[model samples]
Target: MARLNLWRWGVFGLAGLYFLVPLAASVVFTVDVPGQGLTVDAYTQIVGTGGFGSSLLLSLELALATIAVVLLLMVPAMVALRLGAPKLRPVVEVVCSLPLVVPPIAFVAGIVTVLKWGPEHLSRTPLFQTFVAIQNPDFPVVLVLAYVVMALPFVYRALDAGLRAIDVPTLVEAARSCGASWPQALVQAVLPNLRGALLNASFLTLALVLGEFTVAQLLGFRPFAVWIVNVSGSQAQLSVAVSVMSLLVTWLLLLVLAGFGGRSRTTSRG
Candidate 1:
């Protein structure tokens, strides 16, 4: 028993050192500048910087949009496949998981080609307006679309697990027998049982959108991650400070998700 306990603690201790070492180095580099006493100067400058507010806001908006779109698209599709067409579930799963196998650079490259070709070939068509609108630098419809694709696998898995745990067919049948429509059945009867899954999917998608750099950067949109890299060029310490803060924000999100999830599980158990 003592040997097993020591092995477990030793493994955990090594993992903690692996994760904390770089974070400690970053904190030191961010605050302990040569000849400058420990100060909040770099952290303070994060707000005053030119693109700080806008980029962060843009990323936040993108995260929200991605969450909404993923939920709307995946939840219903997953439920229907599970309840109505079990055989199609594997096919749907493969499609959702494709984004995982496809490299982000290649995915963004395909989008770039489509964007370029749309203007040249489809300029006279109504779809050209969509192309123009999606590229909007302010709120980036393109980024949201890209993020939705990137987040599909995570959202699908979360919802699928939730669906597996519950009696989906029975729930829908009961809701229907109670004179509820399909939408109501899903919105009220089904989704309540899926609160944890919903929160988990939202948190994962939000974190993915916040941390994603290659797609947003290559797509010519400046989001939170891109801004950090841009700021690093002239203000190294400030960039590290912002990166540390971003890490904290992501961790905070995870904690919030866990809290809500725990409450949800307790309620379900009761």
Candidate 2:
């Protein structure tokens, strides 16, 4: 037992070093300006940086939109597949997983093509406004649509796993027998059980949107990730500093998510 414990700690320490070393190096790079020795200008300047706040805000908005839309579209479809048509679950799963097979570069290319085609081919029709509206730089609906597709597989898997763990049909049936309508049963009994799954799906979608640069950059929109790259050319140290902070934030969120999921599992077991 002592030997096993030592081995466990050794592997953990190694893994920690592997992650921490690069981050430490990045921190040093950001603060240790050649002759300045150590300064925090890089970190401090982040707030004043021209596009930093707007880009971060835009990314957060996109993340929120992506999470809400994906969950709304996926949760009911998955529940129905669970309670009504079990065999169709596989088909839906395949459809969701299709995004993983498509490369990001190709995906952006297709989006670009569609955007170009809409202006040229559909310019005369009123529906052309539909295309124009979606591409609005202030809040691009097009990005949300793309993110929903990208997030489908993760959302499906999380929800599916959650459903499999509990007896969905029994819960819904009990709710129905107790005089609850479909919407009420779903809102009350079903979603409560799916709390952890919903959180997981939301976090995954949030991460995808915040980290995604290809689609946003290709579409000429400057969200958080692209802003990081854009500033790198001029403010290298500040860029690194921002990168470190964002990574720390992401890790913090993951830890919080893990704790939430762990509690849900514990409660379910109890």
**In model 1, where is the ten-residue run with the lowest total lDDT?**
260-269
Stretches of candidate 2 off by over 4 Å are 252-270
lDDT of 1 by residue, 29-56 (tens): 9888789788889999999999988998
Clashing pairs in 2: none
Structural similarity to truth (TM-score) of each candidate: 0.93, 0.93
The stretch of ten residues in a row with the least summed lDDT in candidate 2 is 248-257
Maximum-lDDT candidate: 1
lDDT of 2 by residue, 1-270 (tens): 999999999999999999989999999999899988889999999999998889888888998899889999999999999889998977898999999999888998999998998889988999899998998888999999999999998998899889988999999999999999999999888998898789889888888898999999999999999999999998788889999988876778778877877787788778
Report the lDDT of model 1 for residue 207. 92
List candidate 1 segments past 4 Å from native.
Answer: 256-270
Q: For candidate 1, what is the lDDT?
A: 0.92
- Overall lDDT per candidate, in order of appearance: 0.92, 0.90
